[model samples]
Structure formats: C-alpha cells, structure tokens
Target: MLKRFVVLLLCLLLLAGCDQPIKSGELEKVGLLVPETINDQVWGTKGYKGMLKIQSHFNVDVYYKEDMNSEMIVERAVEEFAQKGVNLIFGHGNEYAVYFNHLSEKYPDIHFVSFNGDAQNENTTSLNFEGYAMGFFGGMVASHMSKTKRVGIIAAYEWQPEVEGFYEGALFEDNEVKVEIEYVGHWDDDQGAILYLDKMIDEGADVIYPAGDGYNVPIIEKVKEHGLYAIGYISDQADLGETTVLTSTVQHVDKLYEVVAEEFDNGKLKAGNLYYDFSDDVITLGEFSSDVDKEFENEIHKHIEVYRETGKLPNE
Candidate 1:
C-alpha cells in the first residue's frame, strides 16, 4: 500500500507539470504584440478578443504589448518576450509581421505567428482570412438592401486584402449598382472616412461600409445621423445606435488562436502560411439591421442561405 501511494503521488506530479495543450490544464506561456490599442474596436480589438478566447479555453499564460508601430520598438518588445521564455509570440497587425519575421530568423528557438503578412520562415507562420469571400457576401447583402441601388465603401488604406475584398464583394451582386470606393490613407482616420461617406450619401448612398480603425465608430454614427444604414466588420455586435449594424464580416480569430495553440502544444508546429476563407465558415455574415426594408432583407437572407448551405453566393 505504501509503494502504491508513492507511485500515485509521482504520477500526479507528472500530470500537474504537463499541459493538455490549448484545451486546458498546465498553462503555456504566450506573448502577443499589437500595433494599436485593443480599444480600437476594429482590427486591434479583434486581436485582443482572439487572445482572450485562447486564454479562456486553455491553460495558457498570455502577455501583451500594444500601441507599437516602429520597427525598433517592436523588436525590443519581442526580444523581451523571448528572454522571458515565452513559447509562442503573436504579432497582431500586418505591418509588424516583417519585423517579427526578421526576429524569428535571429531567434530560431521561438515560434512566431503573424496575422496579416505572408509567412516565409521556418520558425514563423502567417494566418489570414479570405476577405474576398466575405466581401462577396457583403456586396450581395448591400445590393439587396440599398434603396438607391448605391453602396459606398470607405477603406483606411488602398492596398490591403480587406479593402480589395470589400470592393469585389460590392461589385459582385449588381455590376451597375454604382459602388464607389475611397481611400483615407490612414488606418485610424475616422474623420476622413466620415467626410468621404457624407459625400457618397449626398450622391444617394443609403448604405455605407467603412473599414478604417476604431474611428469607424464615428463614421457609422455619422451615417446614422443622416438616417442611413451602415455595415460593420470583424464582428456583428458593433453598435452605433438602436437598430444599427446591418451586419458584419466576422473574422473567427478565436478559432484561429485555438487551433494554433493546439499545434504549438502538440509539437507539430511548422512555419507556413495559413489561410481561412468564407467557404470554410471562418468568415461569417451577421444579421441585417432594422433599417433595411423587409422585402430587400428577405432577398439578402436568401443569399445568406446560399452561403450557409452551399458556401458560395452569386457573383457580386
């Protein structure tokens, strides 16, 4: 009996020291770096939510540093994380990927993941969503809901995959719907987005989608002020007013983090590019808002049904 009890105690100790991966028990230490504050409620906030989801599910320790843009600052932040023996590091924004990739090369022992940029190194990986698929669905929804047959898009930058996705989605449903696109040149410039959106509204735009930073809140609110409907991104819960949020192209960041954490824990982690498309159900559509007409909303719902069932919508 004494021998059996000693063996049981040793087994318990071993089990306590081992982690079951991203699921739970024996937390693993991971670090996350962001280009902006999580309060941005757009891209940066999405990243924060993803990290939080990972923590909630798994026995994982997470450390975060936000509001870093410069290469030098990011480099220092990553280095500090490495010194602290963090097993995995996440660079939240696309702009920070390049620097993180460089650091990954210098410190091959660490595993690094980038949300936007392409993953090129053996020690680093990239994960991205297929914005085009979401954009296509958004366009279908906008086309059916627009009373004026006019929809407008406000993008923070001209070159991002997300911007292109929005453009393609809007144009897919009706080629003649008069979809207009504008670039504000900065990610956080809500004021610029509002100026552009107001101009489009004057031109008879009844629905506007702005893909800027946290400032998008102001732009959407401005649209509501003019009695126009608005769309959101990253998720559908974005509330600017009563009956606000026509829908959203939500990024399944929580799922991404959970899968990546599992791979890291299982010791099968590899450096490569990871892409999730709408067809894969990683990017999803939210509910249409009250501002949309019932008849039009039904039309949009039909398309959503197609997306849910067939994973494809009619051409934008």
Candidate 2:
C-alpha cells in the first residue's frame, strides 16, 4: 500500500495550506444572501426558512438580501452586513463562495457559511450534502415504479453526485433498465430542459428525475402532462402532483441553519468545509406519493436504515 500512502500524503499536504483554523464568535446578529426571491419553493426558500429558525432560536436580529447573483450586488450586500457588524453570514449557494473567500480577510471578525463549493478561507465554511445516498434511494424508487423499464434524469451538471447515484440505483434494482441522462448545461435553461424532456419522453422513459434547482418545477409540471413518474430533487415536490411524483430527495436546509447556530452559540462551529448526510438528518427522502405501495416503501426504508448504521448502500 505504499502507492496509496504516497497519494494520501500528497492530498493531506495540499489541504494543509488552505485548511486554516476557525474560531466561533458570539451569535449576536446574522445575515443571509440569496440569489433570488425566497418564494421559489426550493433552495432560496429553504435558506430563508433556515434564517428564520436562526432568528427565532437565538433571539437575534437577522437580515437578508435577495437577488445576490451578481458579484457587484453580493459585494454591496456583504458590505452592508459588515457595516452593521453581522457576525455570521450565510450565502445560500456555492455561487457566493468566491465572493466570500475574497472578502474573508477584509472581514476578519465575520465568519461566512455557504453550500457545496470550494471554501478555503479561515472564516469561511462550505456545507456540502451527501446527496448521492438520497439519489440512490430515489433511483430505486424510480426503477421499481417505472413501467417501460426505461428511466431518465435531467441535471444541470454531470459533476452532480445524484445523477450517477440515480443511474446506478436504477440498474441495481433492475439490470434490464435503460437509463438516459441529459445535461441542460445551465441551471435555469427552461427551454433546453424541456427539449431534453421531450427527447426522454420520445425514448420511452416512464420515470424521470429532474435534478436542477431553478427548472425542476416546470419540468415536473410537464412530466404530469405526460402522465409519467418523477423523483423530485432538493425539496418535497409532492404538492406539484401527488400521483406523478413518486418521492422527493430532500435537503433540510433549515435544520442545518439551526444546527450551525447552535454550534456557534455553544462555541463548536468550525471552518473549511462541513458535510451533512443521512445520519445527520440533513439529506433524506421526503414522504412517498400514494402511488408508492407500503411494501416498496418499507424496503427502501430498510436499505436507508442499513446505510445510516453501516455507511454502505445497497450498491456497495
């Protein structure tokens, strides 16, 4: 295992330079930044809810700035928070990671928290969800629920863990299943997403997973028009259509905010990057649709329980 040891040593050396120490400060005031409005029923909404939880839990004043995708806009919002002496700031998405990294040195007293991206500053932390586990479960549901023995997935980027998890999970459930995955290349490209949807439909895909944040709602609505099955991503989308949505892979962003606030309040919050998983109750599957029978649901739960205890999914 000398080769493996050498590789591990190199990786550790690479990380050592950027993994600076963090010190948790008082939970006096907090600020949140979202790229879009909180009414989107997805990522932004979850973050808003999380901020509210932090506000209620800590009894501190919380401020939020929407429409923060542009660097200029984000810098302005952060400057405002800095001026107000906000101690902890949450950037709703990975897009804000760079801006936070660049500003961390300037705002030495403020600690920044964001999701799913590169975070290296001593005052910055990235909260990445272990999404593949939930994706595996969603894939199993889609494969088992699929009638044509063909399934499809639409995602913004191939780098997403859920896409591969769904692919493998489908095949694990049924070796004969055909799985097609399409990338829209951009998160908000609704037209491109729909075109991919049409192509998947034409190819006899009966169960689909739309895994993008900005366009999942419209894609699910279109999936309903075709009377097909879908596995919702990031949030509980059963309200979209109970019959069409088999289940949802959920990320409980609000709970995480509470946890972070609690940690900081208790002087336990750390920096660099923190990962949340099924065991942490952060990444999970939402309630199944009525279409999912009790027997199949129980089987999925059994697998999830085993994973939670043993850290090994069915495929492993």
Candidate 3:
C-alpha cells in the first residue's frame, strides 16, 4: 500500500509539471514572415507595423524576413526561426496557410499564426479579415458618388465573397448603379490592371475601385490621370491620388496583432480561426475626402449605426 501511494503521488506531480503554463517573460522571441516588400504601404506595411506593435507591447525580440515569395524561401525562413527558439511564428498572408499547416506539426513547441488565412492545425491559428465588409463600404461610397451611374472593381482574382459583397452593396445602395468587375488574374500586374482600368473607364465607369494588393498604385495613378474617382483598399491610400481617391477601407492589422499578443501573454491563446470585422472595429473606412458631401457622409453614418446595432452590415 505504501509503494502504491508513492507511485500515485509521483504520477500526479509529473502530470502537473507537464501541464504548466509558460512563464510571463519566457515567451520573448517572435518571428514574422512577409511575402512582399514592407514598404508597399498596404498589406506588407500593415504587417510590419503589427510586428513593431508586438515588439513594443510585449517587450519581446522580434525578427522578420521580407520578400519571402517562394515556397523554398518560406520554408527556410520558418525553419530558421524555429531553430532559433522563437515563441511564435507569424505568417502575414493567406499564402502562408499551406506552409503553416505543414510545419506546425514539425515544430510542436512553437505556435504558428496565419494572417488572413483559414489554416487549422493543432499548433496553428488562422485569422481571416472581413474583406466583404470592406467591399461593402467601398461599394456604398461608389454607388452614392458615381455620376455616370457606373462603378468598377478590378480584383486580383475572382474570389466570390468580396466581389459578391461589393456587387450587392452597390446595388443595395442604388439598384440602378451598375458595377463592373474585372479580375486581373494576379496581384501585382501593373500592365493588366492598367488595361482593365482603361476598359472600365471606356465603359463610362467614373468611380473605379481596385482590390488588388499592390496593384492599387497604378490603378490610382491611372484614375487620377484620367480625372476619375477612385476607392482605395487595405490602407489609407487617399494620398496615393489626392483628389481621385475618395476614401480607403483600412485594415488595422496592428490591433489584431495586439489582441493576439495579449491573449498569448495570458496563456489564453488557442489554436483555431479568429475573425475580425467592422463590428470589432478592426476594419474601418478612412476619413472621407472633402469631395464627399455632408449628406452623403450622414447616409453612410446611418448605415454604420445600423451595423453597430445589429452586428451585421447592411443586407447581411
């Protein structure tokens, strides 16, 4: 009986030790993998800002590698971070989901996070942005402001969710508003984006919304050169074309990173998918340009109040 009691006590102690949470300061190293140049002032720059926020808030060491476009480079960067004993590995785009899903098992000790992705794994957490809401906001603005009764969207690909939201929102605002959508088949195709922008302009689209990652640069420039109205995405791109860009649907990635970092510090971070939208205030529209009239701004504010009250967008 004495020997059996001792054995039971030892087992309980082992279990307790095994399940211990990490100490507060022990999780000190963070790694970020960015697929593009951090100065794009859009997706990549937002991610870089998020990393800086994490570093400042958590007082942790942060390391990052930009322009990790290929699979090999991504794999190599992740492995290097893991070998260096990083507490968390943040992959800053949907493209990193595949690699995170595969590598999380190999590095069981570290947590993996995929931004704007749907990756699910034992050690991985995915975060998807509310792109639909962004589109809806832009569409609303375009619908109200388009003098030609026609607006346009040039997307990187035919992702139906965002595209559909833009379509629905435009028509919801004014059923007579015609929205033209064109997919350039790639994210960074300046020439293709320009070609589509010209086509849409030729079709009498006065307000053009470009939804590609960095392609907005050329599209905004084209819209300004052609004296057309434009909507920006991912960041406050109003400065990209001062008078042309009416507003932008900004993604507050730094806030997302802050939330994640706080949860991690408290040992409350879980492996699953987390979503952010307008309801959470992580997704928002930038300040309206002076070109937007007070009445139109009030109308948009009314819709925002409804969304806030119901936790749903207009018609959603």
The best candidate by TM-score is 2
Worst 10 residues of 3 by lDDT: 21-30
TM-score of each: 0.84, 0.90, 0.89
Worst 10 residues of 1 by lDDT: 19-28
Model 2 per-residue lDDT tens digits across residues 69-108 = 8888888898999888798999998888888899888888
Model 2 local distance difference test score: 0.90
lDDT of 3: 0.83
Error of 1 at 281 (Å): 3.6
User: Which of the numbered candidates is closest to the native, going by highest lDDT?
Assistant: 2
Backbone clash pairs in model 3 (N, Cα, C under 3 Å; residues 3+ apart or in different chains), count: 0
Residue 238, model 1, lDDT: 50
Q: Residue 64 of model 2: what lDDT?
A: 96
Q: Write the per-residue lDDT of candidate 3 for residues 45-162, one digit (tens) a residue.
A: 8888988998998778889999888778988998889778797888887788888888788788888888767677977999888678778877888898899999999998886356
lDDT of 3 at 169: 81
